[model samples]
Target: MPIAPAYDWVAHHAMVSPDRSAWADIDSTGDGAGLACNWREADERVGRSAAMLRDDFGVGRGDRVVMFSMNRVEFIEVQFACARLGAVFVPVNWRLTVHELDYIVSDAAATVLCADPEFGDTAAELTQRTNVPHLVVFSGAGSHPEGSVDYDDALAAAANRIDADPALLPVMPELTHDDPLTIMYTSGTTGRPKGAIITHGMSFWNSINLAELSDLGRSMVNFCFLPLFHTGGLNCYTNPAAYFGGSTLIMRTFDPGEALDLINDPERGITHFLGVPANYLFMGQHEKFATTDFSGVVTTAIGGAPSALPLLQMWEKVGCPLIQAFGMTETSPMVTSISKEMAVRKAGSAGLPGMNTAIRIVGEDGNDVAPGEIGELWCKGPNITPGYWNNPEATADAITNGWLHTGDAAQMDEDGYMYIVDRWKDMYISGGENVYPSEVESALFDLAGIADVAVIGLPDEKWGEVGQAVIVKSPDAAGSVLDETAILNFCRERLARFKVPQSVRFIDELPRNATGKILKRELRG
Candidate 1:
């Protein structure tokens, strides 16, 4: 059955359980100062924000409101407010430089821009290039550009008016299930970024997929340390948990030590957690990692990229089985995920196709391959984006015959589990054998003294290309002076000789994008 086209989960939950905690935000100061809002409070705040956007900025249906800030409750509220008014919310990556941000803001043609105090400088620079008419500083003590208002003041004004007479707020436009909900820009690993048009229905279905896959319940307490701009943080678990009447505790930004303390705090009672593999890696390497207790966590998920086997084993050793998922921004960010029950049994598999999701592994001939044969994975589902926001050429190239051809090379076992081997473009053939960097990195991560690692194929004379490993050795290993020979020998025991990295280089850290995904392209360069 289709969800009601006009239904708003926030509004629905606010009405059904007015007193239930909807969202919680931790301060970035790392002092544990935080704030939370119940459903009723959230509804009122969202309504006020909608009123403010409509009245103050003339923002309404089809208009874009760009949020360039770090994670916070206001970020989520602004997004919901945009939903309430049928406006598209574009959450810019705060990690982006001013030039990159300018392209997104102008491309989006956003009328209102919101910034966090931490990014006041970037936001200020953006106003000079983009024609964004209204600027609001959301959370920070730093001074904003001229003519900007404090986000809190804007909301308070609206709330005061609404409190006196709720009827003053403009009537929300009737929306269909297909109304645009968000315009999430891709990470642009290969080319210029393109906004993926996410619809209300796409968000709804993705939440359903998450709830079913994770067994999310009203009692689950989700800790969201991932950035909200990404689908992993927005639609993956946070939104789904909210839809199920569960509470989400969000960190203003990921602080490894702070996250560790939260997980150990019995009062927080964190039951569900989600992050990229790098987040888990950093947390595991933190000084207190060995002493922290993660036993209270009922569900933990890893996305962005496949996690290393050693990282998986580390978390499992602490009684927190980390389930790996495969997705991208184009598919409402979730196509397949390993369920908690099967986390250990199918440790590396991306799991089964999600609800209302179909998968096909197609070979070069454009035909379905036999089970266990590697091919490009194509997905068709309600959660898949309609198309890229403005680039029809890119959209046409991406979606065909109702299937989004995810540029991921994968294999499906006889039992129907999907193992994402590599990005189709990332796989390199060496001596007629296919070598996936992820596979090699997983083996290297299993070594006793490795902290982080990235692998890329480099030109070779004997073979067309050979694997090169870039590693960040653990502190203790550095003290012991672990060398390339140990890493190569470690791989020889666990992998085919041909698949082991032919060369190794040590680095203080790996180059990563804002979302904690290692930039292999940078490594290759």
Candidate 2:
């Protein structure tokens, strides 16, 4: 069944549950704020946004519409608008350098770049370099780039045009499973980022997989603080909210303290949330963590990196257990998720695959590994991405037959639950023994006054490779005399001799990418 003639998710919600709240924006000030819209408003906004893209920006079906922005309501609006207009949307990470973003914009061949005002200069530069026909800036505090269209003004004009005649709304294109819904660039280790083509079917199936797994409902209120460009933010729960006629509170900028206050506010009624471990880690370290209420939050999920067991345990003790999940950008970002019930019981597990998805750990021979044996993880399902955009060689290497070769080392227990060991590239052989850095990091997180930590392999004379601990001291340990010997002793108490980091270096913070994963390459460099 086509989305238009039989089952348009957004249109169905507009008709059946028009008054249901669909979205809100959480501004940066630690004060509760910004736009709120219901399903009816959402449909109209999507229509108007699509109208603006087509009539004002000259975007057409199959054209790439690129967005470079932080977390905001406008990002999702443009996403829906592109889908409605039958254009393949690209959400470029706002944290990328101009050069990196330029590469993505050129590769995507975007006709119009809808961006946040904060990135006005970059957008203008991209327009000049890429020859983009239009640069539309979202309405905000920052200066609008020269000659760029104001998003709000364009939307108003689109509304007027639609009022003059509703026919101005985009005519539904005959889309198929092959039609791309989005192109998300994944920053894989050791190479330039590759744009993964997430198809319409993948999005739809992911929404279904996540909704059923997370117990999503029409009344649920999702707190979306992750970058809208990341699949974790886009598909995890935000898209599921739209799919189920639910609501979401968007974050213009993520601040741990503000997030804590908002999550504790009973009036806002936040039901679900998701974040990378760093997001949760900072929140747990905040002064507000001791008292901020978690009774209102139905569930919160953690992914993007392996979380420290103690971090998960701390959240569990606070009555808000963070559900550990496993996924990547190419998997529509919801390959598997642990339920709240299993969150504590299976504290270190990534849990089972999504109901509609299938994942397996395979040995070097490309056959399934026995339970408890570590192997490269592979996944296949409707929710998985078709392949990378434009790069057929990379696509051919990544996806074998119908399966995506996820370069993650993982193991499965007898119960069928999965445990992600570590990235194959990240796992270093210490004296001929494989040492997973996450395990060492997890043990080290149990230490107080340690805000953040990352373990990377360093070449050694005696051993082929050895672990190096990069520590970010919390405020309590700001000037404390915690020397390398003490840290090594602490790890020696918890880990095997081979797993302990050979060196310890304290720093103010770890170098984390936009999605919250530690940038080990930078550390190695």
Candidate 3:
């Protein structure tokens, strides 16, 4: 017997636990009201949405549907609907400008566009510019734009039209694990973002990897506030929890104070939590930070980048351990993660590789490096992506001999713990010596009065290139604001003289993409 598509799990869940909570969506518009849906409702809702995509929009197998929305029930429904029909769902970063979105939609040859009304101007402009045949608009009270279909109306109509109809009973196509599920566009820190093809198997394997490592179960209640366009938000804990019959609280936008309040609520019994390093930092700085009860949180995971030791120490006060993970959009977003059991001991490390994942740190010769030596990280696993969409050259460069070149410079210790030094492109040569900015930044992360910092190489007349430290100071820091001298002294104590930043520049905050990873390229400018 063949395995059914992942979407069929929703129906299975509905049959087993029809009234069990599936997801609770928090309003993003600053209002506190929420909408809760059970497994049965979710199954029917996705089925209706799928019917609309098939009957109304003419979406079929292998078609591409682009979604431009924040984290909402509609976004989840659309993704399932697309999967039901064997169509690929392309989730674009709503934070992206119209120009960036245009390239992805056009490149994917999307047949239909589904967007939230919050991005009305962008959606209207995109439809006019691209070959997208149908536009479905969702969210808010008033009618949808002039020519677009209102999301609520569309699903309700489809439900009413197809209710109790035997012909429309099997709206979903026969799909296998190898079928493409989504086209997640990378955050293009270097250039134009490429759409990474995510298969059903990759997603399923990642869920399995996480469930085994994190001990996720039906009793687990996770929270999601990250943007859905990235794998960190979609595949990380959200989909994994949903896949394992757990409940998830989805927030449309992240608010540090609001998140603190939610976590502190005793009734929610929020067990599993995941956030980028910056999120933990912000929440640690919130006014309620001192009073928030974190005793209920089982596993607090951090990804997107290696976390600062100081941030981890802060969470330690709340009786929570911050688990650092390392991955990219290409690897279904999970290659290595610090397990809950080893989180404290391997505090700063990316921890061990996933159960089915193999990680290698290869030097310039494309051979595995000795322990403690930095090299490009290569991953081979069932969870790894097949390749990028419509870009064979990029795909060829990314995945070779069934191994996905992660493009991240990493070092592994004798105990098999991995450390992500920096991105290959982000590593720069200063004074004829290799300088990984993350190494420098990690040393500065524990400094007094310093909130955040990013190091970049600047062209130098004598050294070819030199390091520049961009700093963000803690708001309530006492004594005095740190200067170049203080920063230089701090790094001088912790890092090599050549590795120390040549100059220091202070800023209010670091610029980050939607997923909260520092945008070092923007800082370099």
Best by lDDT: 2
Model 3 bad stretches (over 4 Å): 1-7, 28-33, 141-143, 164-166, 188-190, 427-525
Q: Rate the local accuracy (lDDT) of all candidates.
A: 0.81, 0.82, 0.81
116, model 2: CA deviation in Å? 0.9
lDDT of predicted model 1? 0.81
Residue 384, candidate 1: Cα error in Å is 0.4
lDDT by residue (tens digit), candidate 2, 355-395: 98999898999899999999999999988888899889888
Scored against the true structure, residue 334 in model 3 reaches a CA lDDT of: 85
- Candidate 3 per-residue lDDT over residues 166-280, each given as its tens digit: 4674456677777899998864433456788899888888888887667788888888877777687888788888788888888887888999999999988888877776678
Clashes of each: 0, 0, 0
User: How big is the positional error of residue 324 in model 1, measured in Å on the Cα after superposition?
Assistant: 1.0
Where does model 1 exceed 4 Å of error? 1-4, 28-33, 426-525
Point out the higher-scoring one by lDDT: 2 or 3. 2
The TM-scores of all predictions, comma-separated, are: 0.80, 0.81, 0.81
